[model samples]
Target: MIQPIFVYGQHILEQPCTDIQLESPQLQNLVNNLWDTMRNAQGCGLSAPQIGLPYNVFVIDSQNAFQAIGKGFRKRYFDAEDKGIQGIFINPQLLEVSSKMWKAEEGCLSLPSLIKGVSRPWQIKISYYNEQLEYRIQEFSGLTARMILHELDHTNGILLINHMGLLIKKYLYFKLKSIKKGRVKVSYPISTR
Candidate 1:
């Protein structure tokens, strides 16, 4: 069964995730649940903290979504399709990021009723272990890059609202209140209206 995702302003999203050791069955279960939650929500990615689990675990299905977005860095290192965009990332460490930035609208499974415009690095090189505990280095650019950065932020207990300007932060506070009061459902594109 898919677990209930924690909503916006939850304390779990503010706490850093613990690193996952490859040999642990607990890590495996977290990976499985994250994937299931992402697919169930039609989300391109998910982090363990979104489900009230504080572990450095996330899953991404970048290939299909990348194709859907119509553009991506073509010097491919991993099979966009075969990678299934559904692999587990454990103890992820973003080694480097490009100076360039890209603005995109981001949504979270945890904050299912909201979306927001945020800027993130346009490219990044990340190192992480797979479910089997094998180390892998992956380079991502454009949309995939943004998704990875967003999930990484979740692992570190950061939220898109935290990156927004002060005015935007104020707007989000009220918007979040409205959400809690059942005044809205699924704030599309950007929630800070």
Candidate 2:
């Protein structure tokens, strides 16, 4: 089922999530719901908390994002090898990140109509359990890394807006306020309460 995404100002978006029980009967359903919800919203990634669930889980399918933007945009920002990744991440751990940093524009479904240029590591090493509950550690670079880091922040109760400078936050005050007050319009379903 495609769940409604919790918008900004919802306490669930800020509450840190707990590790998912691998043996739980609902694990697979939760994973499917996340993927469905993300795809329905046309998002590259989605975390459990974004849907009002408190589990350390997120789904990513950057291939959709790349295809949506077309080849030229992909060629400009990504390497030939960066085809993008598609998978579920459960109880993920950030093992390491490269010193190299890149700043790029990012948007979130929860914060509709808000986009910001955020700086994040170009490469990341992460360990996560896949949909089958198989544990694996892997390294990711470029756009994939950025997407993972963004979703990882969600599991940690950190929003992309948290990365903005004070001045930028001040500049976006009214817009943010409107979003928090459930006044923003978005293509997908969002729950402000």
* The candidate that achieves the highest lDDT relative to the unseen native structure: 2
Model 2 alpha-carbon miss at residue 159, Å? 0.5
Alpha-carbon error at 106 in model 1, in Å?
1.4
Candidate 2: worst-modelled 10 consecutive residues by lDDT: 70-79
108-190 per-residue lDDT for model 2 (tens digits):
99888888888999889999998778999999888888999999999999998898899998999999899888888777888
User: Which portions of model 2 miss their true places by more than 4 Å?
Assistant: 70-72
Q: Which ten residues in a row have the lowest lDDT in candidate 1?
A: 184-193
Taking all chains together, each candidate's TM-score versus the true structure is 0.82, 0.95
List the pairs of residues colliding in candidate 1.
60-85, 61-85
Whole-model Cα lDDT of every candidate shown, in order: 0.73, 0.90
* Collision pairs in model 2: none
